[model samples]
Target: MRILLIEDDDLIVESLTKALTEQHYVVDVATDGETGWELAEAFVYNLILLDVVLPKLDGFSLCQRLRSQGNQTPILLLTAQDTSTSKVTGLDAGADDYLAKPFDMSEWLARMRALLRRGGASLPPLLEWRNLQLDPSTCEVTCNGQPLHLPPKEYELLELLG
Candidate 1:
């Protein structure tokens, strides 16, 4: 899975990146909301981890903009703001989930998995185009019963095409 992490805090970014990478997730980091938005526009990610307070643009605005543009990528807002109003605003702005600061990594990972599983509402458990078969949950592809070795980008492209 690929994740776009938009956070300005270097320490948090480093820790999260390390943990996610160790779990075999491809992570891209953006220090500011503008850069994050640009990257999000240019690439297709399974999930976006956005911090509420951001430079150039706040997470709420970014989430709203992405939704306005019809970007359906699951967005998980990470913020220090832990109030009911803030959580409501984030969800109202189109965030799929929210995680407060100082959150446990396991909880974050669990939420991410849930979002990813629920994100592709129309996607089937198995995709087949001619002899090509793809099982997204396992990241396994096969052609005529033979396993196909695909790099991450290729796999993503195939999934998109499928």
Candidate 2:
């Protein structure tokens, strides 16, 4: 699976990248909300891990904007704000799930798995055209039996136009 992590904290980014990659996921990192927005617009991902308080733009605005643009990618808010209001705001802004900071990693993983299962039902299993194949399950594409190491945006565009 491919996930976009939009967090500014170096420590959290490092840890999450390590954990997700260890699980055979492709982890793409964005340090700020604006960059996150750009990446989200450019790439295709199974999920987005968003942080609330961020530079350039806040998570709520970004989430709302993405939803307004009809981006249905699952977003999980991983922020320190654990209050009822914050949780409500996050959910209201279009996040599929919310995880308070200092959370149990196992629980987080479980939530991700649940979200993926729900989303998996909505998307096509795979896409293919001639010698090209796009596998959404693995976030991989191959042409003529050779892996095509295209960037996310290019890969997404190829999937759309193939």
**Which model scores highest in lDDT?**
1
Model 1 whole-model lDDT (C-alpha atoms):
0.90
Please name the candidate that would achieve the greatest TM-score relative to the true structure.
1
TM-score for all predictions? Answer: 0.78, 0.77
Please, what are the lDDT tens digits per residue for candidate 2 over residues 28-86?
A: 99999999999999999889999999999999999999999999999999999999999
lDDT of 1 at 71: 98
Model 2 pairs in collision: none
Q: Which residue ranges in model 2 land beyond 4 Å of their true spot?
A: 122-162
Task: Count the clashes in each prediction.
Answer: 0, 0
Deviating ranges (above 4 Å) for candidate 1: 121-162
RMSD of model 1 against the true structure: 4.4
lDDT of 2 at 29: 96
